[model samples]
Target: MEDSIRRFFARYEQFFLRALAGEPDPAEVAGLYAEEFIAASPAGVKAGKNDASLIEAMRQGHAQYRAIGTRDMRVRGLRLSPIDEMHCVAHVAWRATYLRADLPETVIDFEVHYLMQQRQDGPRVFGWISGDETAVLRRHGVL
Candidate 1:
């Protein structure tokens, strides 16, 4: 079961990488999301279960990037803390670098706390809260 969660997360990481690279397959991106997945980022609330809205969001985001890149997408820290087999939080550390046509090369760090939902079948990210303590640390290369 633990292995299952790990695999799901690995797949999620790959999906992000693919999206950043501007080659996300609609089906692959769709599969990781639940029918009512909601991710609250700095941008705003994005909620969708179907493919159209999600794909549109992805497309719009891709259009904004001259080059959006990611690296060190590691599970720097993870805990099944306050352990509930069905739900847990993940502390994911990642670096995102971007170079827009209008802007200079900017490397921003991110630490996202994903309120992940685990099922008997596998794990699916249900919701998220960004900009945590680790995010500040990562922004300055402190983590």
Candidate 2:
């Protein structure tokens, strides 16, 4: 069960990284998220009742950047506690080196908590909240 959970998160991370690098079509990436997906960050909250809106928002977010790249993306400390047979509360830490066209390379280290539920297809993210953005910005001298 733990292995399965890890695999699910690994796939999600791969898709997320690919999207961040502008590698996949938005529609394809949206398939990874559940219908009631929400992502919370330091900037604001984004939610989608359905896949279309979620995909559109993701596309817009990708478009907002002139150029963005990532290196050494990793997920650590992935621990899952069951809410039920089909759902779990997930806690994990993420670290990545971010490269943007206008700024020097910056390392982002954050922890994320997620509500994940299993679907007929697989496990999908229902919602997630991330922390440590301010620290990342300070590291880059943005703050």
Candidate 3:
């Protein structure tokens, strides 16, 4: 079970790296989540569905990140706790680096907690809670 959890998140980390490099086919981002999921943060809590609209939103998000001169979103660490045979919660620590010609390169640290469901196919993120990304970015002058 530990092995499976590690492997799952390892692939997730790769996806972040891919986002900066402009790969993973873009649609692959939505594949990280389940059919329905909940996202919570300083902004508010919202329910989301993995669909075409979500895919388009993700594509736009990639563009937005690129526009901000995002260099890399790297996973610094991860801890997983299995809730049951089919459910797990993972806390991922990240270091997001940004670089723009006009500003000094900045690196921000943050963490996100994810709720995952495991099935015959694989593990899928069904929910997540994140920190104040907007404030963090602004503090680093990336906003």
Candidate 4:
């Protein structure tokens, strides 16, 4: 079960990297999210009620940046508890270095918390609230 959880996270991380690199199709990314997933970040809320809405919401947010890059992504902590036979609740802490086009090579060290539901297919990231957004914005003089 631990191995499966690790694999799930690893796959999700790869999808994120691909998204940042402009590789995956929007539908591909949206498919990983649950139908009722709701993700909140410093930017805004993304209520994924359907694949098209979710993809559009994500694209709109990504459009704010000319480019996005991430490195040194690591899982700081993970706790998974069973919610049912087919689902589990996952609380995860992740750390990474984020770079955006507007930052002019400035790197933002970020730590984010994710509340997810581990389904039979994979983990659905329903909640994401970054803890380092304020500091990152301040460092970049955006705040």
lDDT, residue 126, model 2: 86
Of the candidates numbered 1 and 3, which has the greater TM-score value? 3
Evaluate model 4: give its lDDT: 0.60
TM-score of each: 0.67, 0.75, 0.92, 0.64
lDDT tens digits by residue: candidate 3, 15-99:
8678668775657667688999999998999998999877778768877888999988878898987899999888888888899
Clashes of each: 0, 0, 0, 0
Candidate 3 displacement at residue 116 in angstroms:
0.6
Q: Please, what are the lDDT tens digits per residue for candidate 4 over residues 2-43? A: 566667777767766565565647766665666676667757
Give Cα distance to truth, residue 49, candidate 2, Å: 1.7
Q: Which is superior by TM-score, 1 or 2?
A: 2
Winning candidate number (TM-score): 3
- Would you list the clashing residue pairs of candidate 3? none
In model 1, which residue pairs have backbone atoms overlapping below 3 Å?
A: none
lDDT of 1 by residue, 1-143 (tens): 45666677778767766666667778876666666877776667766674688778766765454233233234444444434867777766656565445445556655776766777666777777675534554464434
The count of backbone overlaps in candidate 3 is: 0
Positional deviation of 25 in candidate 4, in angstroms? 2.6
Off by over 4 Å in 1: 41-47, 66-83, 99-105, 132-143
lDDT of 2 by residue, 57-89 (tens): 767765543244454467866988889888887
